[model samples]
Target chain A: MIISVASGKGGTGKTTVATNLAFSIGADVRIMDCDVEEPNAHLFLKPEIEEKSIVFTPVPEIDEEKCTFCKKCAEICRFRAIAVMDQIVLTFPELCHSCGGCVAVCPEDAISEIGRELGIMEKGRVNGIDFAHGKLRIGEAMSPPLIRKVRSSVESDKGQLGEKNVGKINIIDAPPGTSCPVIAAMKGTDFVLMVTEPTPFGLHDLKLAVEAVKLLGIPAGLVINRADIGDDTVKEYARKEKLPVLMEIPFDRKIAEVYSKGELIVEKMPEWKDKFRDLYRQINEIGSVKSASHKEK
Target chain B: MKIAVTSKGPDLESQLDPRFGRAAYIIIVDPETLEFEAIDNSENVNAFKGAGIQAATAVSDKGASVLLTGFCGPNAFKVLDAGKIKVVNDAKGTIKDAVRSFNDGKLSFSDGANVEGHWT
Candidate 1:
């Protein structure tokens, strides 16, 4: 089962929940951090990555030898990264979106594709939990490709046929947004655990996130962190939306102080283990109900 | 010559695309005469492939003579280079003014690539 842990607000203990949850589940479990821009799961897990690989994206390369300045390639490129004039084709690599439409429309066949490295991915094991994450190169604006690369690495490690790890669970630390990166992280997951604080900003972003999950047709539950500090807006919204309040972790300085010291909450507080385990059970039950309802209909 | 200025539109309409890929359009203006207009690009088939490629494909379709814009990455450059297009980086001011600068040979093409995240 693939369970994606996501939050609409930043610094809301989303990573904390995801990492601790992975440790609680133990064997046959993995934590894939898909937030390529700023991955902090490693700060807590500190997994000694066993394997590493570079991620690349294909972009067009032009050959200026053909000599016909018809400018058809430029006419076809929507990104404006390519411009043809007076038999000269100018390229702006930074502006390219790599859609390959230029190569497809090039009348002179001068366009070719080349790969550009975006970032690196690490695959390893932490406390028996298989780990995979993408570290986007500093200053990289695009995170989807790196996210995709990490996802591909997960499938590859699951085995060549993708059937060997059919029953394993992958808990993903998704980015904090409703953009393409977040969507990419949550796409194929069987369950989504959205962590949010009880504040107004948290509620606002949570609504957007809920909409995204609903649009993706995925089962989701709410984990309200710092439940007591803020008002009951999230609870009110969740109740109105009929979203399950799976678990609530009260706002405590100990949790915050421990987090600052780079300590996993599950390791520090043995009592919370069972809570995460119960959350997992509830998620499984929700999945079963969904499938059962699908079959009945 | 039927010069095309790199606009934000796709195909003939790419001249109107609000932004080229992630960045603004590459103002495809006449370098010799400084006449500026947006260029029309083509449809990006692999819109899901990646944003860089999508932008490159979009701009290259418009038959732009020169890519005059600020901010872009290697992926976009590869597409422009593949089509034998030259890039003029760090271009500022109005699109027309940039074109005039290019026509007057005041816009010197920079060889160095813009490091990602350096844009103001």
Candidate 2:
């Protein structure tokens, strides 16, 4: 079962929940840090780096020698990446979506694809849990490509990680937001574990995240971090939405100290390990039921 | 020579728009005859990205040799350069006055784009 921990607001503790969950689970669990823009799960997990590979996405490159300024390539480019005006065919490489529509539409066969470096995907292991993350190249505007690369790495390198078990859990620490990167991480996952605080800002963004998850038609639960500090609005919102409050982590200074020092909470406060383990148990129970019902459809 | 001026409205009396990519309208003017055709640029104004590239493509396709605008980004400026279209930046007058400045040689071709790409 794949469980993606996501939050609509930044600093709501997606990495905290995800890393802790992976550290506590005594099963075949692989945690992928899909927050390519700022992957902090590695900071907490501290997985030993075992392998590294560069990730790339294809972008169009026009072959000027093919010589037909037919404007077809430009017309088919939805991103406005290329433009053929008179004798000049201008290509904006950064704007290209790499859909290859321009290459496919070029009757003169003037377009070819070239790889643009998106980021680097690193694979590692902490205890028995396999860990992977993507570090995006600085100044790269888009991150969904790198997020996809991190998720795909798990599938590609599954054999080397461990023997594939039926109950293997892949925990995805999704980027904060309900945008493309978040969707890319949460989509196809068995369950979405939404981490949020109890404040107004948290409630507002949680509504947006829940709206996104509802559209995706996936079963999701909430893990309210700093649960004791904020208002009860998040709890009320969850009740109204019929979303289960799976776990709650109170505002504890010890947890904060461990997090600040780039250490896992399950390692320092051994009691919290059971809490995280229980969180996984709830997810496993809920995820399997959701999947079983999903299959009936 | 034909010049393209980014404008807030379709007519020559309209104010010159400072933005190049998200301009409301592009006025194609003939300085010798004072004849102009207003091209609505709403399509580019709502673009998520590459608005400058699309706007530059429109100007290049319109056969304009000069572009009078308040600001041109690097991407639009590059496209304009490849089309050999001279860009005059920091334009603040009405469309009609901008044409007069172009004619009187008061406005000079900018060395490069005044602003970075993706600027509002």
Each candidate's fnat: 0.00, 0.71
Cα distance off (Å), candidate 1, residue A171: 1.0
| Highest DockQ model number | 2
User: Tens digits of per-residue lDDT for model 2 on A1-297?
Assistant: 788898899999999899889888856889999999888888887789999999888988878889488888877777888877888898887787778888788888877889999889999998888999999988887788888888877753333444554567899999998998999899878799999999999999999999999999889999999999979999999999999999999999999998899998889999999999898889888887988887899
Q: Per-residue CA lDDT of candidate 1, range A1-297, in tens?
A: 788999988878789899989988888997899998899899999999899988877777888786376767666765556655444566656456678888888777888988777899999987888999999888666778789788777754422437757778888899998998999899877788999999989999999999999999888899999999889889999999989999999899988888999988989988999998998899999977986786798
Candidate 1: C-alpha lDDT: 0.74
> Which residue ranges in model 2 land beyond 4 Å of their true spot?
A156-165
User: What TM-score against the true chain A does chain A of each candidate get?
Assistant: 0.93, 0.95
The clash tally of candidate 2 reads: 0
RMSD of 2: 2.3
Q: For model 2, state the Cα shift of residue A76 in Å.
A: 1.8
Clash count for each candidate, listed in order shown: 75, 0
Listed in order, the DockQ scores are 0.09, 0.62
Candidate 1's residue-wise lDDT over B1-120, tens digit each? Answer: 223234443222332222334543444455565554543233332343335545554555666646666655565566656755566666655555555666678866646446442221
Instruction: Provide chain B's TM-score, model 2.
Output: 0.96
